[model samples]
Target chain A: MMAVTVITIVLQRNLFSVVVLAGIYSFLMATVLLALDAVDVAMTEASVGAGISTVLLLGALHLCGGEEAKPLHRPWLPLGVALVIVGALVYGTFALPEFSDPLAPFRTHVIPRYLEQALAETGVPNVVTAVLASYRGYDTLGEVVVVFTAGIGVIALLRRVPRREEER
Target chain B: MKRQMVLRVVGKLFIPYMLLFALYVQFHGDFGPGGGFQAGVIAAAAIILYALIFGLPAARRLAPDPIVEAMVALGVLLFAGVGVAGIVLGGNYLDYFVLDGDPVAGQHRGIFWVEAGVGITVTGVMLKIFYMFAGRGRSLDER
Candidate 1:
């Protein structure tokens, strides 16, 4: 289903349809993540990817118009770059541990401690939340700061600046 | 918007549930699959839906510019403040151990506050971005 959506998005010229297809793709991706037992990630993907992005893109489309413009140049060079990146990613995946492998390096290192001690340590049943909020909090802080920075940047760039006479 | 009776009615029915779900996601993160980030976006979506149905001016009146702007900064500060609180309490920065007498309780408190901060920031930013994009069309027309 996701592949079909992607194909449709790529072939379709209507930007509006592409945006709707992208939302469908995100829902499929969320389902895949849920199947992998990453419920938290799946939820995030569904909301951020399928929900908020669709709205934001539609707003942008309203501003810029809904028709996909014709490209002036051939797409061969970009296609080559994309294929090379895909190859590299596929090659890198080969080195990854098998699905849910208990003895994977990451699983062996901190997973044991987090699983065994998270309840005692944080009293949180959700190990993902415990890890995200308590165990690796600094990273979450950094993420929040990043979000804050992005918000500031967007407001500065997009909000109407005061007219010069008003400033004076 | 006034002419779209179906949309307005449906939006009114759905907005409350959306807002309620966002809060549920926010507070239930400790035991569930959601957290501040998801909750924030959900809450913002409620307001965005209102904007879509009733028009942007109404939504802006509901959320207000100053409060949304303040939320963006306040969430970041709340997260950092919790870190500083740890330092002040004689633990390392970002340490939840010293947040309360019982380390586990402290951990709970710390995570709750941090998640709240994250939710606030996320909700603010999402709304701000939406407003900017949606309002651009009107501003252009006015100019």
Candidate 2:
């Protein structure tokens, strides 16, 4: 189903339908994440990917118009490059540890400390929160700064448009 | 969109719950599967829904441009302030262990503030981006 959605999106020329299909793709991805037991990730995906992005895309669509432009020519070079990159990624995955492997490097070395000591250290039952907000507080702070920076950048770029353009 | 009565009613009904759920996710994150980032996005989505149904002007009126812009900076300040507080309390930067006499309690307090900061910034940024996109190409009077 995910593949079908992607194919349809690639083939479709209507930007509006493409945006809606993209939202559906995000919903399907969120469901997959939930089934994998990554509930935190699933929630983020559902809200950010499906909900917020869908709205943002529509707003953008209003500016750019609804029809995708026709390609100038067939793109055999780009397709071959994409296929090669996909093949490389698939080959690289074979070297990764098996799913849920008990002896995975982090599972043995890093995860035990968090699982065993998180409650005592942070008094938080949710290890994810403890890890994100306490153990890795600095990293999260950096993430927030990045978000702040992006917001500033957008405001600087977009707000500069002369309001008098309406008069023209 | 202005004449779509069904959309307007359904949106009004759903928006309150979305905002409420965003708050729930923000505070309940310590014990549940959500956190500030998710909550912030959810809240922004609620506002975006209102904009879609009722028109952008009403949404802007509800969440004024200046206030929303301020939020983007304010949240980062809050998060950084928490770390500064740790230093002032004689702990290392971001050292929650010394925020209170009890290290665990300090951790709790620190996480709460940090998450709040994150939530605020995210909500602001999302809304600001939405406003920029939606308000593009509009007249000054319309904006």
Candidate 3:
């Protein structure tokens, strides 16, 4: 389902349909995350990727028109780069431990400690929350700052400046 | 402007529930599959839905840009303030153990405020991006 959505998005010439398809793809990806028991990640993907991005893209379509322009130059170089990157990533994945292996490095790491001590230390029942907001507070703080920066960037780019009398 | 009675009615019925759910996700994050980031996005999504139905001007009226921008800054301050509080209390940066006399209570207090800060900032960023995109090309005169 996700692959089909991506293919359709690539083939479609209408920007509006592409945006809608992208939203569908995000939703499918979110469902996949849910299947993996990553409910928190699924929620974020559904909201930010599907909900917010769809609206933003639609708004952009309203300004730029709905039809996509044909490319003036060949995309061979970029396509080759993309394929090479995908190959490298796939090769790298081969070295990963089997899914959910009990003896995996990750499983042998601090996770057990986190699971046992999070409630006592952070007083939060949800370990993810404890880790995100308490144990790894600085990382989350940085993420918030990044979001803030993106907002500032968008405002700077799109906000209209008032006309002065002499300029008008 | 011709307003769709059905959409307006349904939207009116739905918007409150959406807002309520966002709040639930925000405060109930500690106990469930949610946190400040998810809650903030959900809250911003509610406003975006409102904008879709009632129009941008109305949404802007409900959450003015200045207030939204302030929320962005204030959330960071709240997060940093909690950390700074730890420092002032003779603990390391973001050391929630020293937030209160009871170390566990201090962690609770620190996480709560930090999460609140994240929620506020996320909400502000989402709405700000929406406003910027939606406002482009469509002048107020058109409305």
Flag clash pairs in model 2.
none
- CA RMSD of all predictions: 1.9, 2.0, 2.2
| Residue A133, candidate 3: C-alpha displacement in angstroms | 0.5
Candidate 2 CAPRI category? medium
**In candidate 3, which residue ranges exceed 4 Å CA deviation?**
A161-168, B140-143
In model 3 chain A, the worst 10-residue window by lDDT is A159-168
Off by over 4 Å in 2: A166-168, B140-143
Candidate 1: where are CA atoms >4 Å away? A161-168
lDDT per residue, candidate 3, A9-44, as tens digits?
Answer: 899999989999999999999999999999999999
Which candidate leads the pack in DockQ?
Answer: 2
Cα lDDT of model 2 by residue, B1-143, tens digit: 97998998898899999999999999999999899898999999999889888988899999999999999999999999999999999999999988889989999999999999999999999999999888874544454
Candidate 1 TM-score, C-alpha based: 0.95
Predicted candidate 2 versus true structure: per-residue lDDT over A91-168, tens digit per residue: 999999998999988789879999999999898888988999999999999999999999999898887674546543
TM-scores of chain A across the candidates, in order, are 0.91, 0.93, 0.91
**Compared with the real two-chain complex, what DockQ does model 2 have?**
0.79
Model 3: lDDT of residue A75? 99
lDDT per residue, candidate 1, A30-146, as tens digits? 999999999999999999999989999998988898898899999999999999999999999999999888889998998999999999999999999999999999999999999
In model 3, the Cα lDDT at residue B63 comes to 100
